[model samples]
Target: MALPDMDTSVGHSFGLEVDGIQIKQISEVSGLKMEQDVIELKQNTADGKYVIKKLPGRPKAGEVTFTRGLTSDNSFEKWIKDCHFGKMSDARKGGAVIVYDFEGNPIKRYKLTNAWAKSLEISTLKAGDTSVLTEKLVVTYEQMEAE
Candidate 1:
């Protein structure tokens, strides 16, 4: 048997989109995780022997976090407000995050169902230091699917 061909080109985590909006200059994206609960059962068998069995329980999706360089646009702020302060009917929008290869091709995509912003933060500014302003956003969703 022959091994499958490996891709050597470096893939970047920079390109990301949220609900069809292109987010540029993203520094970090994290928390694409899923976990399942494990149920352990203990039983006593014959001859005073003990046995343990494990079973799978419910599955959960973790929160997704995005960090990007701040820009002049207020889209992210508006989105956050919509989730927190806007009309209840307009909140909780579904979105997606696309990961691209170095050549600007989509390699993996994650769909977020009924997502809402849980928290938003801005980087601190200093008078003497030169640094780009950045925004950090954390979002929670009902479900996440890989496409």
Candidate 2:
């Protein structure tokens, strides 16, 4: 057996799901970052030579942004409000960003914990401009795991 082509996967084949909330449609999702900090230390030798060593620090959690066309659906907005005014014990939620194949089978999943909506914004409206109304949501999570 040989190694597979990782690039065979496409970026557009993905979706986001949150616990206890039904996600109808989302056109774009971005800022799913999984990263860590690097720590450097210098050790001084007796001969006046110093050696620099690098170590891994803590994991960093990033805010993910989702954009979708505005509709009658208000679940996302409600969730955002719940997180903003709800008690700390009942606000956080769990969610996942799942990547699927062309056949609709799941290929990868990024599980999130203690996730909550950080912000929500709606596109500016014009008098009679022929444009689609869109809403954007930013979500923050305490931790994430990829599988």
Candidate 3:
């Protein structure tokens, strides 16, 4: 019998999309973390020893951060303004972060429910530097689902 060939392809981190928008020149994406609380209970037993019990609590998702070079478009800034100052109802929007493979195929996606921009930072400017302007966006979401 012949052995089946295994796929040795690796996924690349070249492109990502948020809310159906193509983000240009993404430097890095971090903060995909989840944590849970541990609860301990102590009880007295007939064996003259204390019995310790461990319980697991709810899990929490951490804030996700996306860093990229600043672009000419002001859509991100407008989105921030709409989230905080827009007169329209239901300003918050849910988005998805789709990661692509080396061949530009979709590998994984994280759906962010009720996501809003928690913070936005612009890179500092200098008089005699040749660095590209960059922006950092931190988003907070109610829940995240991996698909």
Q: Highest lDDT: give the candidate number.
A: 2
**All candidates: TM-score:** 0.81, 0.88, 0.77
Query: Best candidate per TM-score, number?
Result: 2
- Candidate 1 vs candidate 2: the TM-score winner is 2
Mark the regions of model 2 whose C-alpha exceeds 4 Å error after superposition: 1-7, 20-22
Cα TM-score of candidate 1: 0.81
Q: Which residue pairs in candidate 2 collide?
A: none
Ranking by lDDT: 2, 1, 3
* Model 2 per-residue lDDT tens digits across residues 1-147: 212466466778788888845476888888888888899988988899989999999998778899999999987888788888976566688899888877777888888889889999999999988999999999998788998
Per-residue lDDT value at 84 in model 2: 84
What lDDT tens digits, residue by residue, belong to model 3 across residues 1-147? 212256433434645456667767777877865567788998988988989999997767557888888988676677667767853244456677777655666666778777777678999999998998988888777778888
Q: Order of all candidates by TM-score, from best down to worst?
A: 2, 1, 3
lDDT string, candidate 1, 5-104, tens digits: 6854343544556666786777887898766789999998888899999999887756888888899877678778887775545657777777766656
Clashes of each: 0, 0, 0
At residue 138, candidate 3 shows an lDDT of 84
Q: Identify the superior model by lDDT, candidate 2 or candidate 3.
A: 2
Cα RMSDs, all models: 3.6, 2.7, 4.3
